[model samples]
Target chain A: MNTVWKENALQVIQDIFRNQFFDDSLAITEHTTPADIEEWDSLAHVNLLASIENAFNIRFTADDMANIDSIAVLLATMVERGAC
Target chain B: MAEPTHMLMMAKEHCKAGEHARALEVLRSLASRHDPLPMQAQYARLALTIAQGLEGLPVLRVAFLAGSTLDHLVGALRFWLLLEGFRLEPYLAPFDTWRQEAADPSSGLYSFRPDLVWFFLTARDLKLEALWGDQPQQWQEAAAGRAAEVATLARQVLATLPATVLVNNAEASATRVLGNFEGSVSWSAASLQRRYNLELAQALPAGASVFDLEHLASCFGLERWEDHRLWCHSKHPFSLEAHAPVAFAGAKLIAAAKGKARKCLVLDLDNTLWGGVVGDDGVDGIRVGPDAGAAGEAYAAFQAFAKSLSLRGIALAVCSKNDPDLAREPFRSRQGMALTLDDFAVFRANWDNKADNLRQIARELNLGLEALVFVDDNPAERALVRAELPQVAVPELSADPADYMRVLAEGAWFETLTFVEEDRSRSRAYRDNAARNACLAQSSDLDGYLRSLEMRACWGDADQARLSRLAQLVNKTNQFHLTTTRYSEPELTALSLADDAWVGWFSLSDRFGDHGVIAAVVLRFRGQAALVDTWTMSCRVFSRGMEDFIFLKIWEVAKGRGCTRLEGAFRPTPKNGVVATLYDRLGGSSVQQDCGQESRWHFDLVAPPPDLTHYIADANGSGN
Candidate 1:
């Protein structure tokens, strides 16, 4: 993974969690799953993804969205798509 | 036991810990105990997290009756309302239930008894195929048919409920049936939708509001807003991206419904209103008004925007740490300046602290600090007001002067659902109030000042034309309201029309200018006695003997209506302490005294008080 892209994406994701979930202590890792955060429900997942797209100024295809559920896959997809 | 303030602090900690439900519970408990810092924006921020799950915080019941799917909208709206320090309980009608729910009073939708109803109809419901078909003769028929249907629905809703109804305009479909020829077709989908929205707006009664969703959709870009996958999956119309903006817009309308709209826009002069400081640059060097430069034009545009806001009834005030004469120079001498000295209700241009100046402005205008929006380019000054007066909204102005207007408008501090004539003429009225103050300062004593002003008060029954303003006074007047009961226009109108109700409005004018509808009195008759349900007056008219005059008028009205006795109550709220001794001043005797909540007072109307009527001219234009 590109460390710069991963770091940038993680910072943006952290802000989204802080704002949307009131999770100021939320620290995203490569292995973090939806189960790790109670507020990472379906509605919030969509909101988080949309916010990420806005932050990066990139559009994700349906296939990319369907596969990018986990942080590891999200980072890989961002790298593949050159979003950061 | 933790103090209420400590509980509020703990609630903040709970919110930060992602225990939003607990945070909300704590906040609610604090609210129940006492008013929990009502104007604190931080509390509003905390509400966003758990509002979707939590219920019962003085809900403004809203019924969503729609033609298309609206499940995606309800949660979004609830979240935004909560974020704006409001609780909303949504009653969602089944899909395609707009016509049925609007037409029938006994429909399941009426069970919620919504304070506001939103009609979310789409282009699909109009069956655009019939309008855009090859049959050219059928275009007029199709258009009329759609218009009639929407008009019928509007009428049914108006007749059925006293709720403020918002009808969403149909957005044009991105799909092109006629391809390149779509622009030429008179009854194309876009044209039909636009026409329908226009007709619907005209057809809706005065109480019903049109949401203008078509314009909003266009602004968001039609293609990006309508998610095909979501539509296919769950009949969701708006994209996930559009949720916040749409919800915020709806919440603005809802906030206005509850009279939570901010009133005044207090401005800072140095580097905020003008590009350069008046003290440092001098009047000629400052970048304001015409032909100064790009920066000057931007400042000029900002002034024009502020002027427009004043015209919309938002009072303007200036709080600057400069010489009063120096501050007056730009408005006095500068060419192409949109704002004038008369535009502002109060101007504090001394070296006093900005927050203290803001408080002075609030006191002079008889407005709450919560109603004030402080706009200062200086981050330090904004921080000062935010710290000292937490109730005042200090919006962070952009570094770029050009973006000031956009930032202020987007802040949505003064978002109101209805803009009556009273709002449009509010600035002029306040300017007139300044004249009255000047006259008062010049006079020898209280009676001398009152008699010198040549004040004329036009008293009448509160009718349709004045109903909205009466309700607005009831909602916003805190310090001077005797029994702070907020009512909507419909409820106020119903009260005005009731046989057992006496609704009186007082419009006072002097040698200076007209203070339109300065006071409102609502009385409910109980056999031979009358109960003062609502007695509210503007703070601007305070100590002007307007209160005494209105009290006498209320007594006369009750007597004329064959009521033998009159009663009034003072309800204790965080803000209404000023009116606690109001009944005592009116020569009223204590009747039903509640230790904490309310104190009721009774007055026998058989004999009136000695004439304090030297100030106001009679209703028939007869001078005192």
Candidate 2:
């Protein structure tokens, strides 16, 4: 993985989650899963994905949506697609 | 709360200064426009500003009964309606329980008594999947059946309370499971959904309107509009970015239905309407009309837009801070232009404040200041009018002339429920009215001038042929009589056919042109007296003596139907005091008076005033 790209992507994703979930101080690590955050419901997850796409200028396929259950999985998918 | 954005800070300052409306203006512009701020950031930034602290702003209670979860739309709708100066009070019915909530009298929907009820349903809600491979017969039957089913739900809510209802037709799924064959086969989901959409619209109860969600989705591009992933995960109807546009459009539609539509568009000259200042750049130098190439085409397109508005009954006027002669030069000598000087009803070119000029335009047109919308390219002028005359709409238009039409069209300032035949002549009628008023000012002999005008009055029942015009007048007229009620078409239809009721549509025209359905009145017969249910007339024909002419026919018809007396009432609004003494002038005696509420009047059929004189003659040439 590109260390700089991974660091920047995580920062963007963290800000989106913080803003959309109305928690100004939310933090996420690569190990975090959907089960760890109660507010990471389907509605918020969909909104989060859209916000990331808008911020990163990328599109996500349906397979990516289904496969990305954890932050580690999300990073891995981004790395595999060279989005990172 | 997070750090407030610059626009949010402006809203907060306005709130602090007791300028809640101004605050809404800032926030609404931020949300409605395609701003640089991302959707999630914008939505998150505006979440806490639901404005519950503001006092005395007009409130609109809205209930959303949708097949899918609408938690996000409710928030965005608040920001949109706030721009229209209404605080939203939303009641989101439980997911997919719309049928139950609408049917049960004791449901929260009925108890909440929303001013507007929205029904957002889709193909899945119609249960077309059950008929999947079943024959083409079930496709047709299911569409009709499901439409009737949902229409019944709407009727149930309407029966309990009087509210504006908007139903969303089913969207044709983009999946295209049968690929290109979807268009060819009647059994395809998309084809069946299209049929369901048509049936749903046709089956809706009277006064209810379809929201055209399918068209909206198509405009947004179906690929971007739908997300099967979100649908499967949470049953979200459309994409998250779709919410803002939907809410903005939905608010404009509701505003139109509530009679908040604009009647006049006031344009600014110079670089605003065309390219370059007329004083600096002569008619030949001014970049307008098609002769001027690309930049000129932009101005011509904007000019074409204003012309189209005039053709559709929206009065146009010119207010420029330049010399009158120079301002008139462009429209007079310019060739290949989309507009002419004759297009404008009122033209004032002087160094007055544009805000006061807008007021003068409204005064000359006999319309309220609320009826006018000011468009100017100068930011200072826009800010000035927005500050001085808050009632007149000043859109946050982009500086680029190429974007003017898109901005204006998206603003949806001039929306109407129905278009009457008279709308085609409405702008021209305003122009002619100026001539009539000028004639009124110059003539020493009022009676001679009135007689010389040669006015004609046509009267008829509000039958199917005239129902649309009748409904248009009733909806547009706020206060032309004792009671002010905007009746729907179905209600007007029932009244016209009722044996014990007499409803009339009055059309008046002089040598100028035809004024279609200028006035309409409804009366209910009970015992020996006819009670006036509603009597509304367009403000355009005021002072034309049409009132007396219509009153004469009212009594003639009432007496023929065995009525011995007539009862009416006078309700006062802030601006309708011009007609405060109307019933008195019509020879009606005060029966009861309730200060600040209503005043009742009674007129005996044994005698109408012998001196009730009008210059208008019957269309049949039977002048009595």
In terms of DockQ, the best-performing candidate is 2
In candidate 1, what are the lDDT values of residues B281-370, reduced to their tens digit? 888888876688888889889999999999999999999999999999998997767889999999999998988899998888878898
Alpha-carbon error at B418 in model 1, in Å? 2.6
| CAPRI-style grade of the A/B interface in model 2 | incorrect
Candidate 1 wrongly placed segments (more than 4 Å): A1-84, B1-13, B16-57, B68-72, B128-130, B133-148, B178-185, B607-614, B621-624
DockQ of every candidate structure? 0.10, 0.19
i-RMSD of all predictions? 8.9, 3.5
Worst 10 residues of 1 chain B by lDDT: B32-41
User: Second chain TM-score per prediction?
Assistant: 0.88, 0.86
